[model samples]
Target: MEIELVNCECCGLKEDCTQDYISEVKAKFDGKWLCGLCSEAVSDEVKRGKKSSFGMDEAVKAHMSFCGKFKSNPAVKVADGMRQMLRRRSGDLSSSSSKKFMRSAST
Candidate 1:
């Protein structure tokens, strides 16, 4: 298995990967190779079926644009990614103090 250095199309992260693995990722993401994290993120979007017309190409493009915005600062990139994840898991954070769950009065 020959190892190749590949850069992620979306997040600009680089990794040493087997040629077979790289080709497999390119096949899945429209000829662009993505790192594990990015591929998983894009895959998640596809699985959600949030947009009827969205597909792998669109998801890759969307993530690429998102990563582009944060490429200058790796710290900010991670922070923003975490924020987005939190929002996705906990609903929108627009109302900071609304409430997550009612306080169970079991005292």
Candidate 2:
């Protein structure tokens, strides 16, 4: 199967995160998946006085659900190098975009 190099659903980084990390985080949070960078950014923004937000958890959950569909598939064990490749091409996922992604993902 072809793996999509989407932005990490945790941190808003446009990196191509592995399906494993994405799935793990997604399942842990009710299907809301944040890109790795976005996830950290949200936490950091919160620390920087940004107001609290919602729907992130849902995005993570979606990511998890998406991954779950692939569980037991060989793609789940994709190499770390592939993730690095995605990261290299990833863009800066803004908090706003993160929210949008989450909202769209949930719907």
Candidate 3:
């Protein structure tokens, strides 16, 4: 098999990749790999923080919060799943959450 050197779809960073690198998002995201810096940018945005032109934007974070909320409660699902798909397609949903949210969400 030819090894793949896909660029980090989040920000076009590149590296040798395998399936193990996919983020554990809402279980339906499909996109290319993300380098460390771009990944951080996306992560910050997903957490509902201020948008950084040097980093991810606030719009990205709000969209992720919307996805998270929808995933946690099917009855309260807002917007179609298409939003999530679009974000993933654009490689924009890779932001990491703060530990506080992670701890609570995992529980």
Model 1 C-alpha lDDT per residue in residues 2-70, reported as the tens digit of each score: 888998888777889999999899999999999888888899988875669788888998888878887
Candidate closest to the true structure, highest lDDT: 1
> For all candidates, what are the clash counts?
0, 27, 6
Candidate 2 colliding pairs, count: 27
TM-scores of the candidates are: 0.65, 0.30, 0.33
**Alpha-carbon lDDT of model 2:** 0.53
In the predicted model 3, the residue pairs found to clash are 8-13, 8-33, 42-95, 43-95, 43-96, 45-61
Global local distance difference test of model 1: 0.80
Give the 10-residue window scoring lowest on summed lDDT in candidate 3.
70-79
Task: Please give the CA lDDT of all the candidate structures.
Answer: 0.80, 0.53, 0.46
1-107: candidate 3 lDDT, tens digit per residue: 34466654433445665555444321223342445544554665655453434324443444445434532432222234766778776664343345557888899
**Model 1 regions lying over 4 Å from their true place:** 73-107
Model 2 superposed RMSD (Cα): 18.8
Q: Give the distance in Å from residue 46's predicted Cα in candidate 1 to where it truly belongs.
A: 1.0
